[model samples]
Target: MRRPSGRVMVGAAVVTVVLLVAAAGGAAWWRWDTQRQPRVDDVVTDMNTAVADAVAAAGEDAAVAVSPVVAAADCRLGPLRPGKIFTGKADLYTDPGGEDALITTIERNLPPRYAAGRGTAVAGVRPLQADIGTVTLSVRRLSPGWLAVTARSRCSLGAATEPAAPTGAAPGITAVTQLLAAAGTRPAGITEQRLRCTTGDIVTISAVSERTDTGDLTDRLAPALPSTARRFTTGDANRISYRDGPVSVIVASSDDGTAITAQHTTGC
Candidate 1:
């Protein structure tokens, strides 16, 4: 066999080195992607189990509780879209006999941040847990006697994605309409209402209570509003109230149906 020349040997060696480096780089990228893929199923399962366990331990009358740390984990590691999050509410029928004990158990076991979200005044807490891209848990009591537990999972998606548009009618008119419907009344007095869509494309509706106001309708209805509708406020005169509720919000994409929340108002 002919002996290989020095220049030819050097060139072959260079090519081989380049190939090895390329292969190594590809392998590293693949490993990173595999690791980064959110473990949605596992996280969700864990969240479900945690919630169930908390509820079971606390018993039927127990109020709900949530953990902020768990929520952060669910948001950072779960499978939901980045920046998107999950939230839930549970209604618990209060049994007079078990109410006190249940509330005690929830207050002792559930996390504090969650309790605050549910409005501590309400008695009986419900537990909530989630694992998507994020997790959040909270508990609260409702007026007219009901307990609520909520959980949220945040998405990892960044700010670039445009938020979804408002779904129902404009907030000022539609929110009032929804409140009336919930309160079992007819829409009246609302006119020339306009809504502004902000950062999250959030829609806010504000109006002054009309002369026909019969009760503290706005205050009564605020709590009942959907979770998407947040940061509620009343006007200076107490004659006007406003609700900054979502015109459109994202929930889990499931076969059952999309979950929607509406702002509830009584006066104005």
Candidate 2:
């Protein structure tokens, strides 16, 4: 048999090398794709496991401390549908008078990761727990009288650390001032008559004889007011209260029942 020419031999070697490289590349791509595509069943299983673990950790207690956060790498906003809310692990220490305190704490301490608008309120509440770091308690209000609450506990991956020491600093006054500015611009039946500010960021506003016509007041004030503010009936037939942020403005018809009287809180 005649030996193949050097050119032919070289060409053969090149073809073999190209085939080997292509095979290796294809294998790598296949491995990457398989690793990237999380198995649906596996994900479902993990979620179920997490939920079960959270419930088990909470035990029979209505409230338990759990981590509000889960694996950061896998963190997701899951199915938080409109008219619904979600709260991760929380510890329920005591039942407050109402959901207002809880809402305020959440707003001040753990603001939402995303806020579509400044005054937009969460439509509903949904709470959950994590088996592993921060305990969280959460609640959502559906309507004036309807609410849902949940609590859970979580664990941090690191070793136990000392609890953070509490600070005695007074609450910031700016919060109240900002709240007042927002309340003043409301379009309710009463308009701002006078406003006073004190050293501690306290604000007091008095509103006088505006109008008795509910239709006009609602038309103007309701549109401008934040969604968190609402009109609710009171014992007095011709009186109503507008609550926005931390301030509650009481509006009552004047003795003559033709004008409205509004009084805002001190240092709201």
Candidate 3:
């Protein structure tokens, strides 16, 4: 995660303590700064808006997968803090070299006052942190070729929300279909996520599912792939990644078998 914003300092920390108290006691603090302090719902809404702004700046087709509002955690905007926020995943429409291209686009085209590079201390992807007034957005490479955007809201007071179903158009299912056919065992659950592109014409899709049969997933699925497909070796996970088809397909089962996820992600 990224560091806290240093603007308000002591005053913001004091306000955070009050909000945390209100979260526990249902106090009337909500009425004190109805405009300045965002409620939990307000934070989630602002996060979504920031994601949209980023997408528009990139001007690419993408898909979204959002989670419920997570309860109080360390507030990155102030000290001695707790923050409530939701995280969503989205794709940036791209071709080969798209991730870097999209990054360049965001750095050059989006509003400069809000966005800056490499915000989070998180180890994986080097994110572009954008502080768009109400929320902070982190956009970075989700995988080797996928650009995903994640937004974290500032400290707030209010009841958290359950994840709501997002609406968007579906992307091509060819890669996912190829995956399921070779998976051998049926998925315990299947879910589809989509994010509309800035152009409003297309979307990126992610079809995800879990599998219980922890068998030799790689052996069973590898032989089915064409000679053109390449395999990657990640630690412990029995899996393969090949993006030469209609979309990118990744079938990975945990070393113990309970963590398998068959995912369809947009590829460059």
Candidate 4:
């Protein structure tokens, strides 16, 4: 009888020791898991602040104050190539106003693009949680201060979708288009203002204002072109040459017209 009782006591002691070891192992793992994640408070705060600034800048007549609440925050951290991505829901509260109008106002106020240090911010407003709108925001890293080019969808694996290759046109063509959008058609007299991109090892961009003062056009456009590039002038012809990544662009112009050429190959 004494021996059996002794054996039972030893069995209980062994079981207790096993349980203690398991608990300690679990605690260690929990600590490691928590440490692996990034500190996200700063990111969340910046996003919230962006929303507030947008609202304040709107200055709508039907003014309504908005408050944002972030929920279900999930973030993925990586090294260099592409940076971090943070996704969550942004809930907005506004003073009593029609939902549609409030939504429209908020959308109008939101920044077209928020530079999140090479990250993308995708916040979609939807009528969720009892007719109040909620925005699911996604911030993905691009380079150092811009959003990712490829948008995030529910099915994406967090990899940046490769951008489609250009149609072999000089990049300057796009720059000229944007400039035109801002400068608009030359003041009345300039009838034949033109821009052309000829692609090759050296992409050439030509801007001509027929029968118009090239000086006026150059003055208007020179301000629009990159000021950091090395600038040169010859008589009526002004030239700004610079390297944009692997491509070298030389923009030459006069009061009559302008020509921009870019090259990526050796010599010529």
Candidate 5:
């Protein structure tokens, strides 16, 4: 059989190039599609819910602290996007269970719509990654005895929206007010988020503030806490936290690593 002419071969090459470009365009669209919510607030809110569910699956024995829905929401998109990307994070420490073992448990416990992802191992610890659409929940070890579970969303199209302020008196409001007063400097702004946990407890992450100095902040602010408040030490985080009933006040380094920040959480 005779081989095709050079002109025919070039024609075939052009068609292949066109098909490749179309396929590439389609893949990019899929990467940016809104698989779930259409706004940044809604994206982080759903992520918070997923993190809360993972927390419950982690069981009551683990010492859990969650990121503010807005703080862990650090990802940004273009001005005209319809969705946003962010990671809902939780630091789990003081659990007797093996880290990988616990992650496996969480993998099994998330809603079944989440199929397992290609388990990638970082530092020999493979994250328990499960995905539903572009949203994923991943658990991995951060350090010795400290594990972090993150629910991350894809970069889709969305506009950024600040969460609405609490309408009623949250349980931790008084404590937050007192702490802010002791900080002695007015915050630039704050984000108060309330995430509903599957366990029926409303996790109110409130009174988040802009950056301030770390210079003995806890000592200056210790007097403001109620007598019921007692401390819990999280290793090397350069912060202080207290538990009073359902209320927790945490003063940690700001996201920029420039200054201290005070925030509160009401619920586990």
Candidate 6:
């Protein structure tokens, strides 16, 4: 067998280095494309913008870019009717910090309102934990416009809560999450808990407890609530009101007994 010369060895080494460099460059470009936020126009443009911003702000490895729930939505925001809904969802690779990191990134990037110039409306984040927890946000358009962002999600996310003014808003998004955990039989027991801090502060805790009879679901959850809270019964809805510093907490239950909600309103 003939031995290779020095020239052949040198050429092979140089080719190997070039291949490695190309691989690295390709990886970087893929990350940028996957994480870059999406842009839109008119109706609910801010909605798409907000979700995209939140995912990019997350600083995590997201698998895909922001995508419209409706394909045509890419052209412009849709559902130009009152109470019409538009949704967008993006998935993120989990970070070492767990849910806290995801929640913080979302709250930070998530917009408080659709857009200042669009009109007068509010936006809020409500976090829900099922097999895998999710956060959902809703935007209500106060005036007739071309855009309305109904819901958006990052990670394992979902939404449920009424829109409220940002007056005397809760301390932070973290506090709102803490409140939800404190007022439940179990975090998993509450299927949906939404927190909105925009023009106003609102937190809604919804519980569908298997431990209690459907007829007395509210009765079961009321006792588990913070002792400082004053419980009020409005027909079938169980409303629990409490104050922590400037934030006023109201926990309510649906009359049907399937859901219990907590709202930290803007005012007492």
lDDT of 4 by residue, 79-153 (tens): 312233433321222222333334444445445544222212223223211111122333222211111111111
Per residue, candidate 6 scores C-alpha lDDT tens digits across 13-75 of 999999999999989875675444232223243343444444444443221122334322222
C-alpha local distance difference test of each model: 0.38, 0.36, 0.54, 0.33, 0.63, 0.37
lDDT of 3 by residue, 1-268 (tens): 9666686677799999998987866435434444455566766656655565575576432322323335636453345334555454454434334466566677666666665676542334456877777777777875554567766766675666543332443343555545656774444444544334434422233344454565667777777666864444433445655544434456666546564555554422
Q: Which runs of model 2 end up more than 4 angstroms from their true locations? A: 1-201, 210-221, 230-232, 266-268
Q: Sorted by lDDT, highest first, which candidate order results?
A: 5, 3, 1, 6, 2, 4
Candidate 5 per-residue C-alpha lDDT over 103-157 given as tens digits, one digit per residue, 9 for 90 to 100: 7767666676766553777656567777766467877788644688788877644
Q: Report the Cα lDDT for residue 154, model 1.
A: 44
Most accurate candidate by lDDT: 5
For every model shown, what is its TM-score relative to the native structure? 0.31, 0.23, 0.53, 0.28, 0.59, 0.30
Find the 10 residues in a row with the least total lDDT in model 1: 193-202
Give lDDT tens digits, candidate 2, residues 1-268. 9999999999999999999999999899767755554333233223323332322322222221222222322222223211112222222221323334444444343323312112235443222212222233334553442233343323122222222221232232232233323334322322221121122222224344434443234334444445776444332244344545444444444567555444553221
For candidate 1, the lDDT comes to 0.38
Model number with the top TM-score: 5
Backbone clashes in model 6: 20
Quality of model 4 by C-alpha lDDT: 0.33
Q: Count the backbone clashes (under 3 Å) in each candidate.
A: 29, 26, 3, 17, 6, 20
Question: What's the CA error at residue 148 for candidate 4, in Å?
Answer: 27
lDDT of 5 at 124: 61
Clashing pairs in 5: 81-157, 81-158, 82-157, 82-158, 83-157, 83-158
Worst-scoring 10-residue span by lDDT in model 5: 69-78
Ten residues in sequence with the least summed lDDT for candidate 6: 139-148
Instruction: Put down candidate 1 lDDT per residue, 1-268, tens digits, no spaces.
Output: 9999999999999999999999999899767865666443334433443343334334433222221112233344334333334333333334343444555575565544333222333334343332223455544444323345454444433222222233466544665555555434544333331111111111223222322333444554556456644332222212112223213211111122221122322111
Q: List the residue pairs that clash in candidate 3.
A: 4-76, 63-195, 64-195
Please give the lDDT score for candidate 3. Answer: 0.54
